[model samples]
Target chain A: MATDLMSNGNRPSAEDIAARRKVIEVDRLDFAFGARQVLFDISLDVREGEIMVVMGGSGSGKTTLLRHLVGLMPPQPGKVKLLDKDMGALNRRQLLDLKRRIGVAFQFGALFSSLTVAENVKLPLRELTDLEERTMDIMANMKLEVCNLSGFGHLMPADLSGGMMKRASIARAIVMDPKLVFLDEPSSGLDPAVSSALDDLILKLRDAMDISVVVVSHDIESAFKIADRITILDKGRILISDRVDAVRNSPNERVQNLLHRRSEQIDVDPTEYLRRLAGD
Target chain B: MANPAKFFEQIGRRTASGLDEMGYATVLFFEAIYWTLTGWRQRQPVRIAATFAAMVEIGVAALPIATLLAATIGLMLAIQSLYSLGIFGAEQYAFIGIALSVVREFSPMIMGILIAGRSGSAIAARLATMNINQEIDALQVMGINPNRFLVAPVLIALVVMMPCLAMWANIVSILAAGLYVSAELNQSFGAYLNDTLDVLKVDDVWHGLGKAGLFGIIIALVGVVNGSMVKGGAEGVGRVTTRSVVLSVTLIVVADMIFAYLTTR
Candidate 1:
């Protein structure tokens, strides 16, 4: 298993290390929405064929960071390099071409409501490839099977359960066989068994297709289970980024607190609280 | 003094925002046109399919309403003109007046307004929903040009279909008016047809069709622009869709006035 080989430091073996290269490089990424700063000088690297789980609490800027990585939001006061090309520097055409190699599965599936599941899965192929209709259909079904939704492609997005929707979205995301896949909260809003099965599917995808996977999730158990490396974000800053074992054994107070599900409490002054309540 | 200053400030802000929206719409219009022409040259399947679907929605599906409105308006116009013209002993001239009005003005203007309300609002709502659902972002992430995929097809369909709808409306309206003149007004059907044919020039037909085409372009632009600019979520989509209908109707009227003035001169 891939995890067995990386159990030491979660680093690829020397023989495998030579074959892997950085696919995504984020340097000094600082983002702000109007007056509120969201991401603060964050940096990270994703290797060619690894599952990197980005975990954060609500409002921790995990989704914002994912958006920046996928070029949905531009890098301001920072740099992001994808496939060795600077995202900030790419023209519209170049950026579009780059997007063809990257697949993003949004949290809510984001499938076209007017199109059936088979149509939704075949959309990328229809738009980007010259494949025959039969070939596209076959390919879409193959992907649906991989996501454990083989026969469900005939249904519409509204007809599917939450877990089914997520799986269908994953199927659509992988239909094009993209070099990089970004799954946003794939296991979110799902039962433990379904989520675990999804985690296994993610692992199988990375191992079989040799594609890099960047998953933004708050599901700690799933993150710990599937990630070769885990990056924890808190309050718009990265708390820790290390191998799964290293993260598990880390001595950092905040990291330990997070792993143990401990919440922090802040003492409030009575006068200040009263003043705020009085609309001062 | 402060109140007056605030009023002027508000006016200035509104003007600036309106101009900004117009500028954005203009850019979108040109981009949609560019993509459509390029895609046609390249024989892009997605653009072709979208164009066909839009044509069915904007043209074929809208025919019944367009015809109904035209026929009712034509009957009303003939009745009103006959009542007034009868006082002057010029009731025989009602055919000429109705023909000229329906062919050069009412059919195209009413058709444009109806389509702006029906198809334009629908386009805005559909695109706005897609915007709120993150489907627009999904399209962008998949290397698909949203404008080429969404707007260009509708624009092409509207431009092609609006004039045809107007022409159909003109024909139905004239026929309905002729029926009233012959049956209710006690005028001979042959004489009424002759009077209408004598006054209705080819130029009148072209002018109405031209105005309809321009109004179609306006409706498409306003719908797409408002939809693409939608922020927030479901509430935003609702707001923009309503605004698109109101703005499209206003723009169509404005364009009609401009065309009327220029063509007359």
Candidate 2:
């Protein structure tokens, strides 16, 4: 049962999985904003055609780690290699070229408000390809259709509901047919049913597109549903990186607290509490 | 009392940050210029449609207010100059003074200030909102340079439109002053117009247009710099919008003063 769950009954053997290419590799990455450290000694990887979910509570630096993977923030005191190319070592032109082979869907669906939904999806194509206008339009509509957003291309992003907007954002992310895709909080702010649907969509996307996916999320249910492997973070440090079943049965008290949705118990000192209340 | 070391440290930090901002703005300005010239060669050509839309937004939309303000300045110039020159019984020469000042100085300066408040604030707010939404970051991830895709078209449009608006202001202001002075002197409007034309040199018109272009560059660079540097979300956008306007206006005035000093010397 554990093997079936881990391999999804159809995936390659353990040896084959181990031999698969690493689409994303992070080694001892650390990040800081001013004097405040956000990510500490983080190391993880996403194998080709696998869905890797990086999950954590709020302020655990999940988003910060995702940013480093996408090359939005440089890895300080460490290295991030995407598709075997070192992110920190790439020049501007090299980085741009590398970026073309990956897609990132931001948490908030970050579509350009001024453009129509179709135009928003087509932006990368328009900016990076010299394709004919008609061809670009067709390609954009096709991607939108894949996200179940067909026939809604003419509307502005402002006109779409939250779900439709997120779907459209995913369409834009995959418009370039990238080998790797990063989704920031893909199921955030959705109803349970909708969230489940999004998880299914992600799994379907990875299988159909043959692309590796990195999802930064706090939604444990969605992560369990879609993630082949999960990396749980706490306070800017990785607590567990393993298969879903192993993570579920882990003996770590913090892991159990997170997995069971148990609220953290804090033994607040009376003097500190009083001082905090008094604004001292 | 402030600790001397702390005070010095604060000053040093501020000066360093200020210099860093100036350097970034300088690079952004030159990059905009470079992209404006060469962006067409890229996979995504420089968007002429976007540039035209910005021209309509920054220039055509401001036309009515600019004309009204120019006419008011002209009327005020006529009244005040006439009063002063009237003491010397030289009120008849007020048109010459108005023509020289409006054509060479006031028109461009007033238009620059107006644009700083109007379009400069708008540019800053728009870009800052985009930044807050992560649209700029999204653009970078998509291999689209925001400077090429967003800033260059706006810079090009403003540089083209500012001189055009300034020329219109010059005409309107001079005409307003002409009509007022002709009626006051009980002379024909045609005679006053002729006097004005006679006093104004082509050099003065070109000088004002040149200043208008410089002010356009200042406003665009300031807005882009402030917008791109915004943090802390919506409040940050509002803060940068105000800063863009204030900084553009102050810089325009200072640049005008420097130009005046250089030309007169």
Candidate 3:
């Protein structure tokens, strides 16, 4: 009865996307690339001023789902409303306006290798605003400082370590102090320590800036450690979308297998198997 | 008990998505055009110097070699055509025929091919390197247009260089063809110059120059677009670099043929 009830509620309520001015609300999204469906009926919400981590295995539509949220890729089969506007329905002027309110740290850090860190930080400010040199510099310094990268402004992104580079990218993303920030695989190539430091920086940014944060990552430890809430996906369906602790303790076999790497999933434990067979 | 209405709604949503991507692609192309022009302010000196240097490299500096090739080809073709005409006792019209045909047809086509091979390859390689290094994405994330930053200078530079190159090729071919006829065929230099002048008009040369300018843009745009999209490891960059030159050349030839048909007719 509970399963039937849950399935019946899959349809988004009339007020679901239209209600609150959520930072992001994905309503029953179904996405496919021709015959290969990547996401199926994914319904979720990213509230204002909260850190929501969308975690899943590789090829589980983590990045694809994030792209839809950021307006880089339009939502398919349902609406992805960001800040109360459907991303798919925005006009050119409105889209630009909407994009200005968000920041994205792409999977690769996406820093312009040609420009120095200072110039990279200077980009959004220069293009979108009329701030004077000193003001822009001040803002750039503040963002860099937030990322713990103040003195190294003039250095190229190539000069930074993997962790530092990601921080710099994060700094660039938030230079606009956007209402929403999206990060795709923030800890992909970094060491554990560096990854933890990045998590600390993310938490610091969320609290300090008071902005909604959505991170798309496949790293299990990093996800569990930093995610306030975890949305686990398998085969394009949401296996679990709840608090990290609740999802951790859930009884769903698929969710359990994903979260707790299913030791009994294989043949038997070596010692137990040996003892039982030997006794026989 | 089934949401059959939901199924058709899904199809409509997919259709809308395809249209949105098409719209974004169009927007990106124009943004690239606008950005290339304004991106100059981002890195003023180096960007300006690099573009100016590309113009000099492609236009003024390559003039001598380009002229030599055009002239040599003109001489060989003129000689061969005159020999064939001489069999029908139309040998005396060699200067008129060669001057018109070479200046109007071959000059622009050769210039297009040369620019596509040299400048196009250089552009593709540079864009590929920029892409590999993440500079293009950097510009985009920064809200600065990479097209404005990278493509604009090359596009502007190519449009300027191509006409000048074609003119240089025209002059060189005419001079070499004149010398060849004067020394070997015992045709007077003054006679060769006058006959050629009578057959070739300002419009013919201008039309050919116009084609060269358009062809330059085609080649440069092709190089930049292909190069900017290069991804993965070194092999990916190499593959796109090769594709840039090949595609540019192919487009140039096809464009030239169409332009030639239109103008000559």
Candidate 4:
């Protein structure tokens, strides 16, 4: 199935994105785990009011990159700038202030099990603002309504299904009306209907709230459905980042392999295989 | 055979890692202290409700077991002390032996070990599970310091509760010993209690309570540090939980020894 960026025509081109403000910018980011390198010379940008999907197969460093964008892991030997603040240079107070401007929904719900769903949604507000408890409750209810989780607030996270948990997590992420939201694997481990609903929520969030979103996902269909721009990561490097049609029509073999769900068959030498089997 | 140099290298690595972890725990301990003092200044004051919740979990919930164990220990101490003092034909001083030992050392040590195994392991497991589930990360992303929001309340609760539990144990154990001694000597329980109180100075009780407080800090710091450093997944939670209890118990004993020596000297 082929989708056309040009025919849709309302989609912004690369030049159009350049004119918009960049909410998040990563420059030459490199990350490593002890002796092993996981992210290499990675550079990407999320513009204002755009849903940027970073897609890759397992272990492709998409989650690592998301962590950097959300300021969970400081970028080493590189830079990550969010809302025009250098993440690595910020002091404690400054870092907290910066964090308040963005929100992150982890892959799993990550709701505090001790708290009810509404309490989880209101936690950031409660921690960051001295608003009256009544006001905070109303605000939490509004966000929950926005995420289509209006009455489920009284239930514990353990009581919610996978999809409801993800929605509640998103509600919490956006409750503070953060300028940017980072969602990690929102559609993962959900039925297609639920995943589609999450995708619709992402779209609604961007269009209605005017918030930029960075989603780390390997789901090709959901990525294409909601992402204004897509960055394809393979083995710690960006293979291609472009409009959805450009990504779809790209000549890159790995991108095609991912899009087509084709697994690459690695050819092995018989002698090497036998020798390795024999513990040579 | 493993190379001799590799063995030394392994030892060196382990030593360095151990020191590194201790250093981290020290830093976190100080951070918890700082947050506990200034947490009220927060835009959203760290809720007293959390502290009370922790008190319930770390302190109130363990009351029954503490009572049962301390009573049994009191009986055992009385039986042993009476037999030893019987040879001198001074069974009348049996209350003094039981009271001094119970108030000065045994009560605090037992309370510490109990809390370390029960609450300390629980703290480590809860925090590790939070870490694994990314709830800790969620808090950080929400501009809340986990040290302030999570660790400080637990630290305060434990520091407050350990002494209370220890003091309660002291009373329970002394009373149990008094009952046994009164029954043995055909003396009134009230007379036995009076003699125990007269012999046991305020300083002795304070010394035990002080050790209990120190053990509280040890348990809190060790549990928080171990929980925060958890890696991987479910197995990591189990490992940290075990490590927290073991380390807290070990450090409590070590600290008790030092405190005993210094206070006595």
Candidate 5:
């Protein structure tokens, strides 16, 4: 795919040109669901061949941001450029064409219940490529092996445990050798041992395939372990987006609170509390 | 006075929602049509496999129920016509009434309603489950058009098989009615056969089959559109599945009425 020229049509500055080389870029993105604004002026970038972990509390708009990156949700008030093309400018065909180079493992694994793990992994290649069936099968098995799900390929999604299903979902996501992959809550429901192993697998995939990864997770240990950079969001706003060490050392109170898992004390007015209880 | 503003507001909301639903169904219908026509050029094996699977599910599987409905209705119609016409000493024309009604209206309408309830609800529920589970999103992320991958095969199956099912229903109903008239109603076999042949025309069969084909498209559109729009979870799936059945039956009935009027005219 040819890199699309920037929409501004102006010659980019040196720093701007450097930023263009990044695999994913979001500039002042704002998103709302109905009357509720969920992502407020969110800005971040994921550089090539790096894992960028997006961490947030529940309902902090991490999934919404991921949706925008993958073209499921359109930009509302800001820019999301992926793979050197403006996401807002692409037509349906162009968006789909661009999606071929991207992979997403959803929060729940999201494997097709009707198909076996092997068939699920083979779906991308089968739909988008002219590869022979034998070759496709071989490639699917290879991906399953990569995700440590080799012999489990013949089983239906219902047959797999949570960790195994997540692995299978990862296998399917990376089967087509996407240049960029998005993983949502990969460690959410796993035991620490399995979660740690998944973290290692994620890093291994990055090194082996040289693919950029954007992971949305609330698992502090997994994020700190796997991310080259981390972006922490709180209440639809980014507290900090920087390298792991910088994030850990940041003076921002919210960042510190999040890093230390501190829950702030609430000071509610007595009159307001009484009014709420009285249904006023 | 009752809240006039709220009453109008409710009416306006319902009208808008109905229009929105119609638009969604229309867009899905055209997308299914476009994919079905161009799908051959792409030669996607999965698509072809889905198409065949749908054929077996929608067509072959519905055969027994369709046959039973047709036979039962045919027998009832024959008995009713014989008793009613016997009052005027016109019992010999019972086969004519039975054949005409079965071929021109009952077979297509009954089969349409039955398939709408069975297959339409099934399609909606399956798609709603896929949606809730995020498999649909997974397909979209993989650059696969979900409509092309899922809806086209179903559209093709329903359209092609609906007429075939109607034809089967037509035959079984006529045969069942013929038997009832000959043995139970004390009419001769030769008289029943001759009366049926005289009353039934090629145009009648074509009209019924054509109506059945339209009903098939209605069911496909309602099922897929409702399914694709499903949100929430298991409750949403059940709700949309029921809605798909109701909407499909309503649309089939309306379409059948139009076809009946045009054919009779």
Candidate 6:
């Protein structure tokens, strides 16, 4: 039963399991931005159905890795492949096709400012498919409700708060019902309760749609709660890649430091801050 | 304790890195190009409307003004020519001066100056503000090219309207010049018009229109380049806009001089 639950050790493999395709594979990737060497020989894969979390601190090149996956910032020629295409060599039309297959939720939930929520969600449909008005409206509403935003279709992004903005962006992202989704810092700015609700949404979305997900975030509790597998990156390298339970039980000092919250503390004394400003 | 020679080498490295910033600007230019191209198509109404607004602001709004302003500048050139040639008792030769200067130089230069103030700075300001608000980054993540979507259309629109503006200016000014000589200098308007047409050959008009086109290209390039290169926050966008306007206008003037020098004898 433990083995059954282990389920291929929470790693993505190109093997057939219920006839679903593997979504992402990064093979011994060595990436750099002009000698900074952001990713060092990183190797990983994400299956067609699971929430795989890339956990790291702010500047740990996780975003760089995500950009590579989306082909926003290209990696060196031969290291990464998405949806079984040689992503490095795919021409514009092919790149567009693959990109359409995937959905991305950015850190700030980068919704188009000029577009209303419904229009933003309709963008992918307009670009890729020929769905009619009723169908488009129905599909858009369903995704909106999934993100807990049912009828706020006419609201612009500027009208949304941080939490709603992420929800709306997620709605826009998955409007196409993409086979794979990439989310960056979904829980970063929200309160804990709202953040957990977002986590639940991510898990439900993944399960219901059978969509593969690669989420980049540093929120430990959120990562553990939602992630089937977590790959921890440190100093441009994957420090540990394992199932959630394995990671929790492991005695690695860095892991322990993070889990226990014993790393460093900046105690805020209102008196001290006031005194410092006032020059006691 | 590296060698004394290595100290200069270190300074050279610093200089090289500083110069890498320009290369980064070039990269931003191409990045804007790439970003503007990759986006999935959007809903027709909003796309069409935003495009319409951009065209109206960059092309239509500026067209009549550019024409009228350049025409008036040409009229002033005619006035100055009549004044200068009137002294020499060769008021008919005023066409030689006004037509050549207005068609070959002033029309394009004034048009460029007008666009720099009107559309070029506006493009820079828009891109800068968009940068502050993360629209460009949003476009990138969504696989859209901000440059191709935003700047390219404006560039095309400017290129389209600039020639129209210059032609309008040419006609208005020639008419103004003929009227000026007829009323003020006691010369027949038809004789002045025929002389003007006779002296202003086809090559001269081509040369002037060609200069106007170059001016349009330079303004678009500088404005887009500066807009894409803008970094920092909201205040930074404003700074980039200001700098872009100044640079575009100055470059237009300098380019006009180069055009004049090149096309002259």
Interface RMSD of each: 1.8, 1.1, 4.7, 1.1, 1.7, 3.3
Per-residue lDDT tens digits of candidate 4, residues B49-135? 999999999899999999998999899999998899999999999988899889889999999999999999999999999999999
Looking at candidate 6 chain B, the ten consecutive residues that score lowest on lDDT are B38-47
Give stretches of model 4 more than 4 Å off. A1-15, A266-280, B42-44
Worst 10 residues of 1 chain A by lDDT: A2-11
lDDT (10s digit) by residue, model 1, range A1-280: 4453243233354346336788999999999999999999999988898788998888999999999999989999999999898999999778977998999999989999999999999999988778999999999999999888988988989999988898888888888898999999999899988887888888888877889999999887887777878999999999999877789889998888887687674346778878988999
Cα RMSD of all models vs. native, in order, equals: 3.6, 3.1, 9.5, 2.8, 6.4, 6.1
Measured against the true structure, the TM-scores of the candidates, in listed sequence, are: 0.91, 0.93, 0.76, 0.95, 0.92, 0.80
The reply for model 5, stretches above 4 Å from the true place, is: A1-20, A265-280, B40-46
> lDDT by residue for model 4 over A104-130, one digit each (tens)?
898998999999999999999988988
CAPRI category for model 1: medium
Please say which candidate is ahead in TM-score: 4 or 6: 4
Residues B181-203 of candidate 6 have per-residue lDDT tens digits of: 67877888888888889888898
A-chain TM-score per prediction? 0.89, 0.91, 0.85, 0.92, 0.87, 0.85
What is the C-alpha lDDT profile of model 6 across A149-258, one tens digit per residue? 98788899889989999998888889888888999899998998898788878888887888988999878777877777789887778878887777878888877665
- In angstroms, the error of model 5 at B207 is 0.6
TM-score of chain B of 6: 0.80
Best first by lDDT, ranked: 4, 2, 1, 5, 3, 6
Give residue B121's lDDT in candidate 3 (0 to 100): 86
lDDT of 1 at A59: 97
Task: Give the least accurate 10-residue stretch of model 4 chain A, judged by summed lDDT.
Answer: A1-10
Query: Could you tell me which residue pairs clash in candidate 2?
Result: none
- Residue by residue across B62-118, what tens digits does model 1's lDDT show? 988998999999999989989989999888888888998898889888988999899
Better of 1 and 4 by TM-score: 4
* Model 6 misplacement above 4 A: A1-21, A128-142, A264-280, B1-53, B131-134, B145-147, B172-183, B186-199, B258-264
Which residue pairs does candidate 5 place in steric collision? none
In candidate 1, list every pair of residues with a backbone clash.
none
Query: Which of candidates 2 and 3 is the stronger one according to TM-score?
Result: 2
Q: Worst 10-residue stretch by lDDT in candidate 3 chain B? A: B37-46
